[model samples]
Target: MSNDQAEPETRPCGLTPKGLERQKRILDAARDVFIEQGYDNASINDIMCRAGGSLSTLYRLFGNKLGLFEAMMTQTSNRVFSAFEAVECAIKRQETPEQALKRYGHLMLERVLSPEAVGLYRLVAMDCSSERERIQSLFYEQGPKRINDKLGAYLQSQVEQGNMRIRDTEMAAYQFMEMVKGNFQLRSLMGIEISEAERELAVEQAVELFLYGATCR
Candidate 1:
């Protein structure tokens, strides 16, 4: 093909590649600083020094301190949603409601027990007094409410197929999730990491309770 007829090829410029890497480095450093010092105490200088980048890049990439925090929050939201999406995809492929529910529970337990999630929860707890509204909104937007919505849809499908008897699926989903999260997650937020054995016990217990309640007679 002639140059005029050839399709244009995309190429990564040096600055573009370096800039993307720089942004990732900044985010990683910021996460570490936030984990160590919590949100209110973490400073831009600390992040920059740990990131091994300059002020100009930080400002250009994330604007300011609050902007950086918002960026981190957005990243966390995406990470959680990505996990949810993976569970949903697995559910779709399995074509079995019971298996889907089991996979969903395991995926959620994994996400909730992650170190970054633990740090974020701790940061929110510390900021709740002054940042109550933001924290509350983030919880609903990125966590419980979304998960409940997905579970409700899944339960409705199971009911339609006569695999489960789900009356008031939304409420059922909420109750089931509360049972799953009631104490373990609260302890996780308080920085008490549940050991492997404890997590396994919780998962098995939750699965048993859910299957007992939802199984068709």
Candidate 2:
């Protein structure tokens, strides 16, 4: 074999278990760093320092700071919408609509009201750079839109099962989410933790209101 036949360099994508763990550390640190310092003020060096990795490694894995930020956001979005993955299973298991919705609403609120989510939302909203639209678009595509699609599918399934009457599942899906959220989530962004009892009441009321609209008249 000719010496020019050089060995293929191992690409440093965090696909393996070890690589995935390393990527997780970087993402976790990046999340905190970005939250502490807005995107404009945030730096790759700071993320690398917190993540205990070299800048070259970060660059090799993610094209730039923006790419890394997107990756971090995607990870967070995946986590936030993870509970929805079980919706189909729960429905198949014959769980009551209220039971399924209560669990989903609780998880959704928990994620939406979390400090990190609030911080991320603020970061995206405050960002006015050229890449702002790209970032916001990716944020929604990877996060909210994904959750909405899954929820819409679940609602459509219920409608077919003779349990509800919904003209537009998509509209109803967002309506339920909005009704459950309301101003409480906005207050959460301002660092106000509404009482647990209050949140429960809101969720219960939202679910009841939604059911009333969905049930056959």
How well does candidate 1 match the true structure, expressed as C-alpha RMSD? Answer: 9.4
| Candidate 2 Cα outliers beyond 4 Å, as residue runs | 1-17, 213-217
lDDT, residue 91, model 1? 46
Model 1 CA deviation exceeding 4 Å by range? 1-15, 128-132, 159-162, 165-168, 190-197, 214-217
For model 1, give the 10-residue run with minimal summed lDDT: 3-12
lDDT of 2: 0.79
Clash pairs, candidate 2, are none
Best by lDDT: 2
Candidate 2 residue 173 Cα shift, in angstroms, is 0.5
Per-residue C-alpha lDDT of model 1 across residues 1-217, encoded as one tens digit per residue: 4311233233223457778788778888887887688766777888888899777667766666666766777777677656676645654675666567667777777887677777777777676344457655775666677777788887887788788887799998887777666687778777676777776666667778887755666
TM-score (all chains, Cα) for each model? 0.76, 0.86
